[model samples]
Target chain A: MPALKKKITKPPTAARMVEDIIGCKWSLTVLSLVRSGVKRPGAMQRRVEGLTAKVLNERLRKLLRYEIIEREVFAEVPPRVEYRLTEFGNRFGAVIDQITALDEERS
Target chain B: MPALKKKITKPPTAARMVEDIIGCKWSLTVLSLVRSGVKRPGAMQRRVEGLTAKVLNERLRKLLRYEIIEREVFAEVPPRVEYRLTEFGNRFGAVIDQITALDEERS
Candidate 1:
């Protein structure tokens, strides 16, 4: 019998996951707004400019699924909701800080 | 005359640039390979698996435009061309490290 070659498989890498999350349109914009203190959906929309509410909601849901951000719903007449970064999400700050430093270096 | 609302302009931020570069398909994969010591195009294509040469060239050109990676040409019989991360590109290590840490933490 002939020897069979082992097939190589590439699992979803952490870098790939990170790339997918940020690859979506407005994903980074939404994350940036949330990190900059704009937690409410309405606030993010206003700050981002041109990001439709539908897209914002989609990104928020995806971010939640990835455990990047957490959403809190308050029991109120209007059902207030706020989004914040989780511990894992906060770790992304280091990446953002490095990017900011690079930008500063360029400008 | 009625007062006019100041037009808000959001200049491209460093974080946005970083997102743009990494958002492209195979961008991170190529960078990861290079950072892992696979600096040749042929080696990168082989290691990344499924990345077409055309796409790799495009991503490399974009990365060059962003000043993320620098190219070196060696005078040899085959005219070897190699790519390596620039100082700015090396800074992306922080982001990748954070992502790796997050992945490890999750697992």
Candidate 2:
């Protein structure tokens, strides 16, 4: 078996953590759409122009791995699977709002 | 000559702009160090662990292109060059602070 990667004892700097979360292509766009209530994967793909399903899935998986978002599965007729921001994710939303405000201030 | 990319500009969304600014490797770390008064390029590279001069220069160029940081040159014995955040850059700092705070809150 391949050797497991060493566990990181030192937590990353907050800026580094935030950068990792947002650095991937489509990550921020996916988060923004989720914050705006586009929770379903199909909806998110439709909302973010030019974002392919494959790319969206990748972004969503990353966000899930980071614990920034949570996935809920329902046993309904259509078997719904939806995503929502975790508490941490909501906190991130606040940061995004601040960034948006900064951009507006400059413009 | 290769066709120039068309520039029919409908400006990007605020979230997209913010992501573009922070998405690159070492971009946020460099920005954070600069905001914290590590103004000189050499100083910044020294301060942010694992940041090479080449990577730092690339990030600096991108920041300059975005008008997020301004470069100043002084004609001294060795010719000093330093970077300072623009008005917009300071605004970005506030956003970074918010992200930092959010991280702290969760931890």
What tens-digit string does per-residue lDDT give for candidate 2 at A19-47? 56555558888888888888899988777
Report how large a share of the reference interface contacts model 2 reproduces: 0.58
Query: Candidate 2 — which residues are off by over 4 angstroms?
Result: A1-13, A20-25, A100-107, B1-90
Q: Residue B4's C-alpha lDDT in candidate 2?
A: 96
As a whole number from 0 to 100, the lDDT of residue B57 in candidate 1 is 91
lDDT of 1 by residue, A1-107 (tens): 99999997544444554556545557878777777778899988877768998999999987787777899999999999999998877776455555556667877
User: Distance (Å) between predicted and true CA of A85, model 1?
Assistant: 1.1
Q: lDDT for every model?
A: 0.74, 0.76
Clashing pairs in 1: none
Model 1, B60-106: lDDT tens per residue? 88677777789999999999999988887787656655655766787
